[model samples]
Target: MISMNCFELFIQTYFTQLQVLDISRACAGEYINGFRWEQLISTSIQHLRIFALQISFKTNDPLMRENTIQQFQSPFWQEKQWFFICSSYSIMFDSYINLYSINPYRKKYYLLGNENTTEIDSMPFVVQLDIQCENV
Candidate 1:
């Protein structure tokens, strides 16, 4: 499992020469705010054209949930055309909020969970879409 700091370092260290980046496995409890914590991305990954990352955080705080979407509303990421979507799901005791990019560098697979989800941009070629919902 890679921490957010490690992901940041990975990008800073190697993304300069890469064009696309994707992290398949979920990053446990790593919260990312593009507005407050992504200055390094625009500057560091000069050659990065597409970035696909999924970050998860365990929380039920409304502010944290809102920030998951609010933080990515900045032009800092939009201008680069890197967009993301935030999802909030409550599975029993734990509430998991995930933030992931929807960049169109490859085949698109979008998943919408049972809880609330917010997306910054839309993907045209959605090969797969999954939605899960259950009454609590």
Candidate 2:
């Protein structure tokens, strides 16, 4: 299991030559913030052109989640033609929101409301992006 800093370091250290990247996973805090990702990409991966990722953020606060998702609407994302499709649902005490890039390598399949159901063939790593959430 890689910590957030370690994951960032891995990308910074080894993926500097990276032209494309595709990742999907549950995330929180800074990982869910688009501005932080923009900063990281700007400072670390100079050659990065195609970035496809689905960052799922879970919280009890809907307003905070909405605000966080707004960070992706900036020019840094738009100028790169990095549009996104977001999906949300509530599971017991937590509200889950997924922000995924809609690009050429964009995700086409989504599995919501069940985090434990991972054996499906449509999982994102091979198919591209998997935005999963817990059951409502």
Question: Highest lDDT: which candidate?
Answer: 2
Q: State the weakest 10-residue window (summed lDDT) of model 2.
A: 122-131
Q: Rate the local accuracy (lDDT) of all candidates.
A: 0.59, 0.65
Off by over 4 Å in 2: 104-136
Q: Give the local distance difference test score of model 1.
A: 0.59
Error of 1 at 97 (Å): 0.7
Off by over 4 Å in 1: 28-31, 107-136
Write the residue-wise lDDT of candidate 1 on 1-136 in tens digits: 4456765675455334545555444444443656534665566655555667666767868677677787787877778777888888998887888888774455343445445456425432332333333322
Clashes of each: 0, 2
CA lDDT of 109 in candidate 1? 38
